[model samples]
Target: MLRTLWKHVAADLTLAAPLLRLHFHDCFVRGCDASVLLDSTANNTAEKDSPPDLTLGGFNVIDEIKTELEKACPGVVSCADIVALAARDSVSFQYKRLLWKVLLGRRDGTISRASEVIANLPPPYFNFTQLKQSFSSKGLTVHDLVVLSGAHTIGNSHCPSFDNRLYNFTGKGDQDPSLSPPYAAYLKTQCKSLSDDTTQLEMDPGSSLSFDNHYYKLLLQHEGLFESDAALLTHKTSLNEVKKMLISRNFFAEFGQSMRRMGNVQVLTGTEGEIRKKCSVVN
Candidate 1:
């Protein structure tokens, strides 16, 4: 069912990126319980409405898969596990290689507040120190930070995501000097203004579809699209991780290990939460 849905929902990086992104958002807040899938009610705003998640797609994909699973075996599959599997398959399909083993039996949470997203999710403008602090606070290592950032290898980021790097960088009428000058000029053509939220730029220029270490190669060239991606070069620990990732032959294995660890963050099992009938709403 996931394979059939993958073709219709994600022929390119558009759907694949959001599936991975939604998984990350779910894992970071409330431990991959699918709290990120909850819909906004009249009394509350959900995480999906958060600024970071405002552009996130693939919500319907999750719903579609959940519907299929319910029809096949009622009250057995969890929305959380569906997201985990979808994220894995999306990367696997794009990379043309298997990535991770997503554990099952995760339950869905009933709460998803927008404020938690702002507090938990790191912005693209965060520097190395800030990014490290954010990930470390969540019990993730510097290794996870670099490996997961590799997801950028197959996604398109809105112009506003990295607008500060292009114009008004450091609150001045100039660009981020750290960004490659040629690449910055090229980005200027694609993203005409900081307010141009409609334009989406590929994070990895030549190989946006493959899930390899080319993102690291691009970072080495200062071609990383986000400030956080460039920030990897500034810190000693992350810099070493990047260099190691670049040289490591076991790319998929290492990524799979990290991905599984990330999926295990604050999970709900053994009657902690419920298996919702609908992924977008609590039963």
Candidate 2:
């Protein structure tokens, strides 16, 4: 079913990034429990409705996969597992082969809250210290932070996500010194202002649709789109890793390892959570 879906929907290339973002956002907030997939109730808001998650797409792809899974084996697969698989398979589009194995057996969480989104997931403007704390809080290492960030190689971020660097870096109408001046000038043209939320910019610039080491290459040039991307250079260890990844042929393997580690963050298992019949709601 995923093979068929890939031929149709994933062929567009744009959808792959959202699917990857969905998995990261979902895992970071509630430990890959698919809590991010839950729809908000009249009385309760979910992570899906949060400002940070408002840009997340590819839900239809997940729903289609779940529909097919339900037809073949009712109540057997968990939405959590589906999310993990989709994230892994989405990366396969670039390399034309699977990057890593997604260990399943995860179950969906019963609760989803918009309030948790901001506190858990690191924002685009996070500095190096803040990014480190965020990742460490989830049991991920600095290596994981630098590696998983490579996912930015294929995604589109809204103007609001990084316009601060382009327009007002320190609130004095100054640009961030860390940003490449020419790149920042180009970004100003694309983003216009912080209020321009509707415009989307390629996170990897020039190669947003392809997953490759070009992101790190650009990061070394200080052309990284977000403050968070530039933040990788603020530390010695992460800076070294970024340089290594720029020319490393083993990037795919390292990325797969880091992703597998990320997929294991604070996860619920062994009857801890339920296998939701529908991804968007509790059974």
Candidate 3:
């Protein structure tokens, strides 16, 4: 049932990136328990309603998979597992050879808070130190930070995610000096203004749809879209890791390992949490 649903949904081509992002966000905030999938109620706001997660897509795809799982095995499969599987499947479908075995048995979290999103999920504007602290806090390493960042090779980011780098670097209306000059000019044309929220740019430029090492190449060229991306070059170790990732073979293997490590972040197992019937609501 999961395979069939994935086959049908994978036809979208665009869904893979967001599903991957959804899993990352879910894991980082509440330890891969699917807290990010919950909807806000009258009394509280969910992580999904948070500003960082507002742009998150592909919920309907997870919903479709959950519906089938519930019909087939009742409460057997948890939404958290579904999210992990969906992320792995979507990326594997796109990258073909890049596959990772997702360790399941994770249960859905009952709590989801909008307030926790910003502090947990690393922002686009984070510098090297902040990015390292953010990843290290989750028990990930410098290698994980560089390899996992390769995921940026495939998505589209809104202007607001990186606009400050193009229009206002230091509150003085200057562009980020680290950004490639030509790329900065090109981005300015597309982004228009600092407040432009509607424009979206490909993270890896021409190779946005491919899950490959093109992102590392862009980073080497000083063309990374976010400050967090450019931050990798700020450190000698991370910069060396970025150079290593330029080899597609090494990057693919390391990405899967990093993802597996990330998947285990604060996960709940052995009846610690309930298997949610509907991903968006507590059961």
Please, what are the lDDT tens digits per residue for candidate 1 over residues 194-213? 77989988888877666677
Which residue runs of candidate 3 sit more than 4 Å off their true CA positions? 95-98
lDDT of each: 0.86, 0.88, 0.90
**How would you encode candidate 3's per-residue C-alpha lDDT over 1-283 as one tens digit per residue?**
4575468546777777898999999989978999999999999999999999999998888888899889989998999998888888887775454388888789889999999999999999999999999999999999999998899988899999999998889999999999999999999999999889998989988887777789998999999999999999999999999999988789888888999999999999997989998999998
Clashes of each: 0, 0, 0
Q: Residue 69's C-alpha lDDT in candidate 2?
A: 87
Q: Which tens-of-lDDT digit does each residue in 127-154 have in candidate 2?
A: 9999999999999989999999999999
- The list of candidate 2 runs beyond 4 A from truth reads none
TM-score of each: 0.96, 0.97, 0.97
> C-alpha displacement of 38 in model 3, angstroms?
0.6
Once model 1 is optimally superposed onto the true structure by TM-score, how far is the C-alpha of residue 216 displaced, in angstroms? 0.4
Error of 2 at 56 (Å): 0.4
Worst 10 residues of 1 by lDDT: 4-13
Q: What TM-score number comes out for model 3? A: 0.97
